[model samples]
Target: MLIRSIRLAGFRNYTEAEIHPSDGVTVFTGNNAQGKTNILEAVYLCCTGRSHRTTHDKELIKNDHDFARVTVEADRADGMHDVEILLSRISRRRIKVAGNTVSKSGEMLGHITGVLFSPEDLRMVKDGPAERRRFVDMELSQLRPAYYYALQRYNRALKQRGALLRELINAPAASDTLDMWDAELAQSGQAIMTMRRDFIAKLSEQAGKTHEFVANGAEKMEVEYVPSVRAEESGEELRTRLEKELHRARQTDIRRQITSVGPHRDDVKILLNGLDARSFGSQGQVRTCALSMKLSELEIMKKESGEAPVLMLDDVMSELDPGRRRLLIRMLSGVQTLVTCTDIEDLAGADAGKIIRVHQATLQEA
Candidate 1:
């Protein structure tokens, strides 16, 4: 539940770096471009297979290096664990736990659950539905390994079905093949939808309470999963519903050369007092809602994993006011937190205590 240390080699701006993180708040203080965020990125990559900064794995390696390695040590119930990720330019990335490779990436999750709060997260409310969907997917993936497995199956089936549909458009004789793919896609998609809806229901319950507290009981925010099809409705019912819609839009899908109906095109809606937050909420409201949602994620992880997860705060306090910053400090006081800030001195009391300075991609105990 706590990151004991992290070792990075040829990752971003850090050539060779090792950090011994404190169980309590550990601040990374440095100016811009001094590798403050890079350290946090390394930690994030170790937990999740991908990065928030970029999708390409090779971009994380050093300019001239062929690969990058990130190893994170954590303290768990049984004992300590070493989570390792090896990234290369030409080959598939490899993941190992305690020196043994794991063929499936979903197997690596939940070993070290972490919540990353970066400046970009503030846009969660204002951005398109894709960002919100990603938020739900990542949070659920960490909390429930089953969700990850189901999601993978659903996505794979979706891709194959789309390809079949594209081919059927050119040759009408392949209609029977399309029927088989439709059934498979529908079954997997239904399972995924069931998991997503249940997860979002739990998330909404926690997020509502967290948002009320963070907003000082002034505003109410709610999250809802608007699936394309309801689960209580039988698969036959779903197929009928989808068939009616797909028949109406067959020509459109052929023109676009993609599958038009399924879970892939669904979305989650966030409502603030009966109005959509993305289009109507003020800037302050949006940011606070996002923060509440993130904190709720920590709560969800704790309940699911039976321990607190590591916290990564990436240059977010700089924009928060003193009141909100104090609230964040209070919530994260006892948890392991890696925070990024330019000047810790500006933060009155909480910031001055337990600060570790970052200079030129290296960390030293303060």
Candidate 2:
């Protein structure tokens, strides 16, 4: 997939702007807070129907603006396509693909796939498990719409189960009502766990090879999915395990007013040379692990979709040392990449593609 252009209206600091990017490597250079990241954010929103930075749509719209509009034009293996997102302050956001309005936002999942890396991603190793889980979720959602559906259902059931648990605390007589939610949660949770296990397994295999190359075979990376329940089982067996676990944790759930055993509490463990990357790996090791995982994502998406996904690097060059930066650039050789940075000189060998200057919310081809 290649993003040919992106048009923004009333998004962040941009009043109105259109950017044409190169198919190989497009660099956006500007100072801090000059709306460089905003461009990448718009592209991400158009692709995923959500922003990585904020969950609230109101935050994306400009001050005093009623809505924020972002339109992206891209070329995929099939053909060219257009994706548009309109975020309104008073109502829900609207999404359209190829000139047709989509009622369900999930329908837009794989229309324009992309993998984004930002400075914050450098801390993913040391960050909480939620960060790692999000990395998996975003990648899977783009590759498989079925996974997205199961995830949504699982979350809804999880929420209802938690609410039932809290209610049971106040009225023990309502305990019977928990059975319905438990069964629903178990079924959906099983599907989610199954997919997560497969995804993590594939990711680990690819990341190991990438990390070896990135780290010059000095460090080996490993990834594993740690489910809250039934770590070794799946399908009906996993569902049965989840049902039993939910029953076992019912009392604790009621007392704690939370669902205790499910995929929500799951984690992905990253290991570097037999050491926990999160707890023992050095800063350089963590960043390299993160990079390897991201590069692995690109390969996974290509395998699943039969084409590479667009790559977005949001001011990530400044966070990496010279050696790592060179490795990352080498990985972007054939993939279409959109990068944001403060200075072009900071990026070695970045002059091969188009250079667009972003200043005062405006873009000019350099």
- Backbone clash numbers for all candidates listed: 0, 0
> Which residue ranges in model 1 land beyond 4 Å of their true spot?
232-252, 351-354
lDDT of 1 by residue, 1-366 (tens): 888888999898778888888788788887888888888888888777768889999889988888899999999877887889999988999999889999899878877678998888866778876788788888888887877887788788677767876786778676666666666666667666777788788888998888777777777778888876555564467656655555555667667888777777778878787788888888878887788888888888888778888888888776776777777777886678888889875455564335767777676767
* Candidate 1: pairs in clash: none
**What is the alpha-carbon lDDT of model 2 when measured against the actual structure?**
0.87
TM-score of each: 0.92, 0.97
Best by TM-score: 2
Worst-scoring 10-residue span by lDDT in model 1: 345-354
- Cα RMSD (Å) between model 2 and the true structure? 1.2
